[model samples]
Target: NAGVIQTPRHKVTGKGQEATLWCEPISGHSAVFWYRQTIVQGLEFLTYFRNQAPIDDSGMPKERFSAQMPNQSHSTLKIQSTQPQDSAVYLCASSLQGGSNERLFFGHGTKLSVL
Candidate 1:
């Protein structure tokens, strides 16, 4: 367990609703990951695994944003009261080792549209 897990490959939600994204990291990999992508900011790091723990979620909104790693195989990101500004592709990744220089295996990403 490391960070959020985004699923569905695509998600659409009305404004003020909730969006829960799921991600299942590669088995045997020690690190799980999450990222957000928008045209304005490109790709932004949300969280990552380090020594089996998650660290550095500075990119996530202070409010209406949360991530959890309940187990080693999966993680989740929940957005409460979704907003249009929250629309973006949520990416999940995993690495054999947890480190800044380690290679990552990335999912296609879950596209979330908040209307």
Candidate 2:
């Protein structure tokens, strides 16, 4: 079975443009997670969902970043008015169980570049 599927492995956008990232979790997984990686912030958990229901989004920036799990198979992360600082590797992970202590399988991640 596939671990996770992330489309448009690499994306480039203008500083003010909007960017959308996609993820397909493994079948049978109950939880999905999103994270951002940058030089300054090694790995920052952005948001997550369990059984297609949003769980936590405290890590997301109130202004331009948002994530949604509309269904079981897929999830989306959107960044509006993109800035250079938004450039980073956006990772998606999923697990059979969700909590502070659970093993998660991650995707290759979508690398976003804001110019």
Candidate 3:
């Protein structure tokens, strides 16, 4: 089926290390978004891109979060100097470059654990 693909379903990292996650979107979609969800903070919009260009990132935290969509079919989220506060389910969703936010299809998520 054509859907978003996220890897490592789970990740364990040290408090001050780097964590890199991968994603593959549906074949022709051009908009991608990254969202972070946690029991304590609910769902937060991290960032989004359209046609390989970032469209909005007003919800991303200021510390160490970054996202990139190098091509039309894939993207990645990288966390530098991870912290316990950063532990959460990282999700990637995609849709057509403009218009209605298509029914976002999510991956199984990459649950991160910082210790």
- For all candidates, what are the clash counts? 7, 0, 0
Top candidate on lDDT is: 2
Better of 1 and 3 by TM-score: 3
Q: For each candidate, give its TM-score against the true structure.
A: 0.89, 0.96, 0.93
Q: What is the C-alpha RMSD of each candidate to the true structure, in Å?
A: 3.3, 0.9, 1.2
Top of the candidates by TM-score = 2
Q: How much is the lDDT of residue 73 in candidate 3?
A: 74
Better of 2 and 3 by lDDT: 2
Clashing pairs in 1: 1-72, 5-22, 5-23, 5-75, 6-22, 6-23, 7-22
**lDDT (tens digit, per residue) of candidate 3 on 2-69:** 57899889999999999999999877888888889899888888998888999998888767888888
TM for candidate 3 is 0.93
Which candidate order results from sorting by lDDT in descending order?
2, 3, 1
Error of 3 at 62 (Å): 1.9
Error (Å) of candidate 3 at residue 38 is 0.7
lDDT comparing candidate 3 with the true structure:
0.86
Point out the worst 10-residue segment of candidate 3 by lDDT.
96-105
Off by over 4 Å in 1: 1-6
Taken over the whole model, the C-alpha lDDT of each candidate is 0.84, 0.94, 0.86
